[model samples]
Target: MKLAIVGGGSTYTPELIDGFARHRSALPLEELVLVDPDPRRLELVGGMARRMLAHAGHPVTLTTTSDVRAGVDGADAVLLQLRVGGQDARSADETWPHEAHCIGQETTGPGGLAKALRTVPVALSIADVVREHARPGAWIVDFTNPVGIVTRALLEAGHRAVGLCNVAIGFQRRFAAALGVPADDVLLGHVGLNHLTWERSAVVGGVDQLPGLLSERLGELAEEVELPAPLLAQLAAVPSYYLRYYYAHDEVLAEQLAAPTRADAVRAIERELLDLYADPRTVTKPEALERRGGAFYSEAAVELLVQMSSSAGSPLDSPAGRPRVVNLRNDGALPFLPDDHVVEVPAVFHDGRFVARDVEEVPVEAQGLVAAVAAYERLALEAAVHGGRERVLSAMRSHPLVLQHERAEKLTDLLLAENARFLPWAR
Candidate 1:
């Protein structure tokens, strides 16, 4: 099958290629096309992918191109993994609104708003490319950040898309490791939205394990917390940077403030990564992989085709004796929230079809938050697509944290002024 990876120049290209190569026997990738605007980076990643494929003894044809149209033409699956702007842009995103409001910019705070504004256009453009060139019924897997929002855009555009985040899988693996169980033996039920998702329930050895039992050993789970925010938050609900910001503001900020913020502190760790990539090493080199690790995150985006096309006409039965993913609307599946939001759950896939496991309602408090975020998400999209300042304001108002800050008006004013480049309606 022809598979195209957009943003092939990304630092994660090596890891993705490695993943594809590792799973080639199952997916049987025949042609791999790497697309990026930077020719130098494209050559670098392309060379690495080819090397990996060769090492795997997979006779997959490899192609590299700077043009999306050319690279994606007739592709079975197109992976969208581009960065709108790199770290420098993120630094700006983190610092801008915070500098304006005397509050530090955060992942989901005003900083997230600004970053999303900068990102949506590029995301839409990539979707447009797929619309023009992808094979009929091709799948578009988005590994972009602010995944909930990006996935919404693709769904709105009537594209077959699913957002893939590796955090859940990484945490699941960590949970198994912590329990001294095989990774495949863990069964997990995931809930919440985007990075906010929690492993609502987990089963080990066919026994249900409550998160409370696991949280008792806080020290042991620190590494897992460091994996990603949503998963980390689920595991460590009361403390830590990511969840604390959303829930326990005073405590989380204090922790961050106490930590070193100097550029040297940040760059010290980055220097090691840069050094690894700087080495003219082969793709299979450990040093190269270590450097590439941070950029890749342990997540992967496998087109349904790769899984379904290759499967032996059986439904993609949900893995048994372990937690698996099942996607469904939020209404009957989740008692607390409205019925229409798309949620992922543990399920079995057999043949090519999926059967999601039923889940109980989320707690009232949690459901309320999800509802608020969903409402805001809808309004944000409406404000962006149509023109409505009130819609945007209402959405922001609905966010409990925004109200808690009492800076909603100020944030709204600042966002309207700063985001004019993206939200022309605000003007």
Candidate 2:
């Protein structure tokens, strides 16, 4: 099999290389392509990847290219992990939202909208290229921010694609470690959109251990997710750390105001990781990448790619694969959502495609929030595809965070101004 990584220059690529080296049997490969526009970072990351693969004795042929068409040609699967504007743009996304007294996050509110507008266009363009040049029945696995909006763009555009995020896998790994069980043995009642989600149940060995974890591991769990202990107990569900931007808006805003932006921190981390990658002696994923966030992302990608590789027409396309969390079409999984709406939930491979598991246990209080934010996502995608100041403002105004007219107006102007240089259409 041939696999292509679109953003092969990223510091996170080595982690993925490590996963592939360790799980070659799951998704055996004949060739690996790293496609990126920038030549310098691409070579640096590629060098690290080559050394890592050789050290593990994984004989996959690896190539790096700046040409997207050439890199993905005849590839069985394409992984979209590109950042349209790089970290400088992300720093803008995380910084400008604070001008409107909004939580400065790259994937939740105004920042997420800004990212979606920039990312959706590029994501669609890449998917189109994959459709035209990649192998027949190839799959595009999106690891981009604002995953719901990006995945929706791909699916709506009639591409064979699915979205992957690490949050659910991180939860499963965390719960399994806490309960002294294998990660695969842990089942989650995880539901909602990409970053917007809550874990209502963590079942290990067919027993719900969420209640026990919340009660017995209150401080530990609450501290990890950055939510207050009382809230977790009251809701009886564990909301992902992203939910802090909603549940404790004021508190998180204060912290953002005082602390340095996450983008700045990540940039520093990337610099260190790249420096390490440039070293020929460093042949493995670095320790510092752990602090760079997106935990367990490599593992999640491996599992998703394995499933996609085994789907219809592929050599391994037989036997239903194990269930895994994915961002896919709702199709009544959430009854309250439109069939075309994208949701993050456990999905099983069946009949040559992934089928979302029914979600019947979302916390009652979270239903309204999910529906409300989902509405904003619709408008956000609209603004992303068809650019207009009014459309952007409409999406911003509809968001639960920047709902007020004045705040939305300010945020819209700030977002456009901050991102104008990097915006796909503006260029």
Candidate 3:
């Protein structure tokens, strides 16, 4: 199999290379192509990736290119990991939202809207290139930020795509470790739109162990979710860390104001990572890469690809039974949301697509938030594909974080002005 990574120059590339090396047997590769527009980053990251592959004794052919069509040609699958306008744009996204007293997060709130507007167009154009050049029936595995929105745009454009996020798997690993079980044995009742999800139960051997785990390890679970233990007990569900911005908005905004933005921290980390990659002796993925975030990303991405590829023989086959959390169109998985809405839920690979596992109805407590966020996401996608100040403002107003009309209008202006360079339509 030939796999192409569209944003192969990212600092995250080496970690992915390490994953492919470790799991080479499960998903054998004839060729691995790294595609990026930045030649300098491609050289540094591609050099490290080759070294890592060699160190692991995995002799898969490695190649690099700036041309999307050339890299994707004949490829069985293409992975989208590119960040439009890079981390500098992200830095601005994270910093500017504070002016409206909103959470300055890259995947939610006003900042996420800016990112979606910038990313969706680029992702669509690349998808077109892949459609024109990749092997027939090839899948587009998107690891891009604002996964829900990007995945929605891809699917809406009639492309074969699925979004991948590391949050659910990260929680699975942590829960598995605490329970002394394999990560695959840990089943999470993870549901909602990407970045806006909650784990209602953690099952082991067909038995829900979340209640006991919560009772015995309340402090530990609270610390992991970054919420108060009492709150966890009260809610009887574990929200993703991103939920902290919504549940404790004022407190989080205050903290964000005091600390340096995450983008600033990432920039510093990327510089150090590049320096390490430049060292000839540094072949293995450095431990420092952990601070760069996206923990368990490589594992999640590899598992999804392997599952999808293994089912190629029967394009419409149902899953073999094990469920994995994925971001794809709802198709009634949530019941409450529209079928076309992109949601992150526990699903299994069947035939050549993802079939969302039957879920117990969403809890009453989560219904309103889930529906509201899904609505906002739809509006966001519309604005992203067909740019207009009013559409942008409407999407902003629909978000739970920016619900007021006046605030949404103000944020719309700020977003348009700050992200002008990336949002060509807005400019």
Which candidate should be chosen as best, given TM-score against the real structure? Answer: 3
lDDT of 1 by residue, 318-344 (tens): 232122453333445665555656565
lDDT of 3 by residue, 1-427 (tens): 9999999999999989989999999889889999999999999999999999999999899999999999999999999997998888898888888888898889899999999999999999999999999998889999998999999999999999999999999989988998999998888989888998888899998898888888989999899878889988987878899889888899999999999989899999999999999998998999999999999999998898888877645443344447789998999898889999999998878867788985555667879998998899999999999999999999999999999888888899999998888777766
Residue 48, candidate 2: Cα error in Å is 0.3
TM-score of each: 0.81, 0.97, 0.98
Clashes of each: 22, 0, 5
Ranking by TM-score: 3, 2, 1
Which parts of model 3 are misplaced by more than 4 Å? 313-320
Model 1 CA deviation exceeding 4 Å by range: 100-107, 211-219, 222-241, 254-279, 285-306, 311-313, 316-323, 326-331, 347-355, 387-392, 404-406, 416-427
Q: Candidates 2 and 3: which is better by lDDT?
A: 3
User: Residue 308 lDDT in model 2?
Assistant: 71
Query: Regarding TM-score, does 1 or 3 come out ahead?
Result: 3
Candidate 3 has a TM-score of 0.98
Give the per-residue Cα lDDT of candidate 2 at 343: 94
147 in model 3: Cα distance from truth in Å? 0.3
Better TM-score candidate (2, 3):
3
